[model samples]
Target chain A: MKLSREEVVHIAALARMSMSEAEIEKAREQLANILENFAVLKEVDTTNVSPTTQSIKLQSVMRNDIPGESLPAEKILANAPDREGDLFKLRPVLE
Target chain B: MTDKYTDLTIHSAHELLKAKKISSVELTKHYLDRIKKVEPQVRAIVTVTEDSALQQAKQADEAIANGKATPLTGIPVLIKDVMCTKDIKTTCSSKMLENFVPPYNATAVEKLNNAGAVMVGKANMDEFAMGSSTENSAFFTTHNPWDLSRVPGGSSGGSAAGVAASEAIYALGSDTGGSIRQPAGFCNVTGLKPTYGRVSRYGLVAFASSLDQIGPLTKDALDSALVMNVISGYDSRDSTSAPEAVPDYTKGLTKNLKGMKIGIPKEYFVEGMQAEVETAIKDAIRKLEELGAKVEWGVSLPHTRHALAVYYIIAPSEASANLARYDGSKYGFSYKDTDSMWEGMEKTKQLGFGPEVKRRIMLGTYALSSGYYDAYYLKAQKVRTLIRREFDQAFEKYDALVTPTSPTVPFKIGEKADNPLQMYLSDICTLPINIAGIPAISIPAGFAKDLPIGMQIIGKPFAEKTIFKISYAYQQVTDWHKKTAKL
Candidate 1:
């Protein structure tokens, strides 16, 4: 699975990042090398093997749904780049 | 009297504070003054909270007057910038969050505050905790307190350097892979990464949620224990936080480990390991043996050969998901206001995230995306299970495992920045512990050609107490923990 320059651009676009032509070329080469390196895993036999998510030996530890304390408006607005009376104003999401 | 206790431990600080010999205000002011003098060269702090610290110290004084002070009450502590602090600029050393302050404090920060620790400042880190050296910080690089020409190791570089320089009593650092311990090794301090879920991650801006663990970076094992006791516990806000019994870690400080067996994994002493590091580790094992502990070589962690690969796959995959929320709209470093929201996000992330971060995110998103999930992401997870099984079997025989915290001493800044694979290999010995979800500590073992090396002590899940006992006992017999960087 060699990553082409076009594929790298697609990933960047999906990830919401802009890359220059030079960066795209660099990323393509790097990604290709890494994919080649990691391809060794294809040699491993994972048949009848289950993927492990949590490393610790525990089950049934999920917490009940509960609300936590919210920071006051003063702290909330403390470092906002643009605030309009208790709201964090942004360029409107739609349009 | 002042000269005698300049390199004071956390225990000594508390005693002096109780006796009214030194107020927290004076202690904070002293370090604050030292930081002002040395920080230009050291570059350890991203922001110094002089005003809030004085105010916190005043509150500590009032608590002391009322005889209601906790062990860490009035203690000045530095936090890694990655952890969000309410009302304080919490830049994770990236332009994206340079002007961003969190509306909420991280559970760890809030817990530390509730335990009465005063915020000294936010320590500089690799951008979004992405790199292994502080050079990646958009703000400034933190120099090693031991040697200015070298780096302090990152993304917890600033925290480690602060402790090593005597600029702060102790500090808190986050470790995903080797962030906390590597810097601690480089700066000649003690760092403990508690078992994942041992500490809450509510306000920790996620890097790789599965691998990231918030822990203590301190001057000694005692301070690490003190800080851990305050920060470790269950928090409903963090669904992943472990609901285990929080023990009094300080109570086991002097517990004897006379017959406790320590395992030294043969795999860790590979060919590429520096000769100086090998010598230092052997000397450390000998010192522990002299303290009535039995040392034995064990054949364990055979899957460690693939640990780095597994980590690279899993960590970036998770990081891609975690970092996706930082679009230009809700975060800092937005592009031109005229740009559309999506356009601004693309432009902002392009300008804001470092090369390494963007690289990881791309790799991760690719791994988890529609077509390739089984080949990369799923395969890595299966290997991760094997890695954990190896540790489980090894711990069944040995009370604890010991290894070099890093294969080599800290390299110069920008030395490996250009080579991604070289940078990734730095976490070889430390990454497996995170994969296995066990508690591990990196303490100053000895120095190699004047550069410090760390001996990593690893234990079973929730066995931090055992790890500390061995570390504390070893320190009691050796002066390595007491040796300060010759800055």
Candidate 2:
């Protein structure tokens, strides 16, 4: 169950985390060790069993579409690392 | 010269407050002074809100003067750093959120605030509530109050340690998989992880959204029950919040355990578990029998063996999705000096999160990735359904389940630091309850060479009152919980 360097790199890309070569090697080793334990799940007989997304039964929650009280705009934006007049300013996504 | 307030329980403290024997401000100041003296060794609190605590205490004093006081009025309490406290820095002990402050209180915090509870400070935790040991915290590891070299089991390590060290009367802790109960066991305190949906998760930072829950860590079962009465209820803010009618938990919490049926699951007593811990739990079970509760052993939960695997898969998968919010674009740390937006996002995650966080995100991404979903994520969910069914059937035959809270007493800080799987094994005793979405409490049962041991009581969903009654009755006869850390 040793994850390859390429597989770890792919997961890091999918997770949007950049790792150095040393970190990737370490992650490959650790994640492989963790996944090896997961191999035990293959022994269970799960025929016709449904997946549980959550433990409790959930229903479609429909509430009235109305705004009662919201956080003040200034306060909500106060923690923004880079804000430009109530807008979160970020680097350009495209050229 | 010594502070008497540090040793007062919520029941006694409430009587004193009502009789005007001690003003709220005086009690609050006593704890703050105690924190100043003892906090150096424990390192439990991340941020001490001194000014806000004094103001809240003054307001509570005025309310008492007006002859209007509630159970928690003017009580000094600590909050887990994962919960947002409006205007107070809520660091999850990570560099990514070291300065992040919310504009609104978490529903639990709001409830405590509304009840006039003074905010002593925010307790530290594992980074993003990810690890079994608080050593994963970016700032510092919370030491077990009993032995400073040992770890206070975590991710709620600081909360449990603070209560054990008498830094705070009680504290709030979140449990996804045994976070609260394990720490409470190590620190010699009572910790309850309420049934999922019993408490609102709004303003509490999400980690494995489906599995995460909030509860109280306190000195005694009565104090834990009183705090549960305040924080457990429905809220529209969290979608998963239950709509069940809230019951007064302390109403029938008497020392009467007559006619209660308790079952002991045989699967939890696996090999490699410490001999002392097993003896302590067995002694506590005998005590329950003495108190009139029928203790049934050899109760079976066949699927218990697979809980650890299912939890690792499901929790990380949910965590990967829940933590996608921390891209550093909104309110947390942002790394923008990179070449492009994509690079900035990647670099923010790279530099902000610690090694364990990255490992989990990687693990989650791998599990949910194409071609592997069916084998890992989907299969785990199906097994989760089976695990939940076993608990449902077991409850049909018993009122509650009894087991050891942790496999062993507190270990040295660096004992399992290098091995992730070994650390995960530490949570084996408490993980099945969370997978089944049931409520459980870890009450101090006995000690092993001065290190405390806790026996866990598992009840059916929304059955906090039953477990509290059993623990209260058990503590009434045994003085194990009254023993405090000699810090």
Candidate 3:
């Protein structure tokens, strides 16, 4: 339950967030406290109890494979931070 | 600007509209003028669609003239910023999505639009619906109307506060734990968190997909039921939406509770619960009994204590995944001064998200990380099943369960802000119902030292009718729901 400073950094990296040294230290303490609170769950014996991912048990809610109208390319790209002629532009991933 | 229409409920407004006593344009203008007057102190609204609302109101008036008006026609409603409304900024009170305007309306919003409801504004909420108080809103904190120094409980704080302050007749809020009900309790309004899948979540910004639900906050239970009639239905876009037929929720508002077995779960009366809250809830229970409800105390939900822990783990884990889409890519806040996409994403999230949001993301990241997933995430889900089973067993014997919606009355704005654990505990009495995915409502029970206290009535899955019936029957005899804040 005790989250070390290094562990906090790792988690933040995985979460794609950067933090100041003070925030990291604070997060370390706060996250550790929250995790400690969660430790109480270990006492509950849930053997053979299936996890309930969703409350409603619905079978595949499939729609017919018919073509439907789509948002225009301009509207689709309207909110993109960087776009070029209706296509979203991202920084080079392979470079 | 007439001050008279500001205090009228959705029901009263509908009657007036039908009788031609007031036009929708006149009613909408009255609320808009009131919003202009009270919004400065309450800070309940994040965006006020004045021009569009008036236009919608004019159309509603035209519809009324043509005899095409529905129940919600011409009524003004505040929407929680989490539910998308086409072209209106759905901020979720997070700077990450502060400028993001959704191109599509959420199914709930679309339904309201179809029913001719006027969009008053988007109500403020905790950043990404992460906090129990509006203090976590990146833009500004919403003050409680009852006591300006106190917080309207959140993340649906603005919706509840808006209704309490008469800024709107009713509002829509998404409850991912105690968001709607807790705020309603704090503001002395009625809010319902429908059973999961009862309402479509198609364009609602997800916090924890499994736990989140869209519901109504109104002046009273009857208004909540009417709004539910418009918003609750199946949608093909939402895979989790139940295929069950939608019912007329307003039909369940009959003030008849004779022979209804109501359970009083003993575990909900915890150590830290405020004495005033306990007394108010006990008094409400007595009133229910007098109204012909058979009250049974000491119904045990032994797994209730683990609900908060389970919620923190599961909800944060889901939120972490859901929020990952907020990187500087398609919409929302973006950091451009970076060498690579990864750095830009990191900077965007770090700068955009608030402290509580960051804390949750980190906690969720850690919990769902490779080595820890089995120990934390899976275990929490298993415990969730146990919690749901407890509710099922209780509902098998009792028609509904009653408890205090929150452990305490509305705290001072900064009282528990420093301690996240303490703030999280504000939701202790309400979280278990969400864990079970059952419909529950917080109705004004009474006032404790001028601040309002809420009594929650919980029902089995997809049993909104039963909960609505109990709440309406209780409201029939109580004057608490009728009392308006002086502000």
Best by DockQ: 2
| lDDT of residue B376 for candidate 3 | 98
Going through the candidates in order, what fraction of the true interface contacts does each contain? 0.55, 0.87, 0.84
Q: List chain A TM-scores, every candidate, in order.
A: 0.81, 0.92, 0.89
How high is each candidate's TM-score? 0.96, 0.99, 0.98
**Distance from true position, residue B7, model 1, in Å?**
0.8
Model 3 misses residue A46 by how many Å?
0.9
Candidate 3, residue B231: Cα displacement in angstroms equals 0.6
Give candidates' CA RMSD values in order: 2.1, 1.1, 1.2
Off by over 4 Å in 2: B1-3
Candidate 3 stretches with Cα past 4 Å from truth are none
lDDT of 1 by residue, A1-95 (tens): 45787789888877878898888988988887777778767767788888888775557667566787765877656555567887887876888
Q: Candidate 1's chain A scores what TM-score? A: 0.81
The alpha-carbon lDDT assigned to residue B401 of candidate 3 equals 95
On residues B370-457, what C-alpha lDDT tens digit does candidate 3 reach at each position?
9999999999999999999989989889999999999899999999999999999999988988888889999999998899999999
Residue B317 alpha-carbon offset, candidate 1, angstroms: 0.7
Candidate number that wins on TM-score, 1 or 3: 3
Deviation (Å) of B386 in candidate 2 = 0.6
For candidate 1, lDDT tens digit of each residue in B1-487?
1244458888889999999999999998988987887788889999999999899899998898889988899988899999988778889998888888788789999998887788889999998888777888998889997778888888899999988887788888999898999899988999999999999988998898888899998878988888888999998777678889999897766636787888899999877899999999989988878877788975666788888888889989999988888776555776765547777778877888888889998999888877889889999999888888889899888899999999999888778878888888888889888888889999999887788899999999999999889889888877887887655
Per-residue lDDT, model 1, residue B339, is 44
Per-residue lDDT tens digits of candidate 2, residues B1-487?
2356657788788899999999989988988988998899999999999999999999999999998899899999999999999999998999999989899999999999999999899998999999887988999999998999999999999999999888878999999999999999999999999999999999999999889999999989999989988999988888899989988888886667889999999999988999999999999999999999998999999999999999999888888888777888888888978768778888889889988888888888889999999999999999999999999999999999999999999999999999989999999989988888899999999999999998999999999999999999998999999888886
Worst 10 residues of 1 chain B by lDDT: B1-10
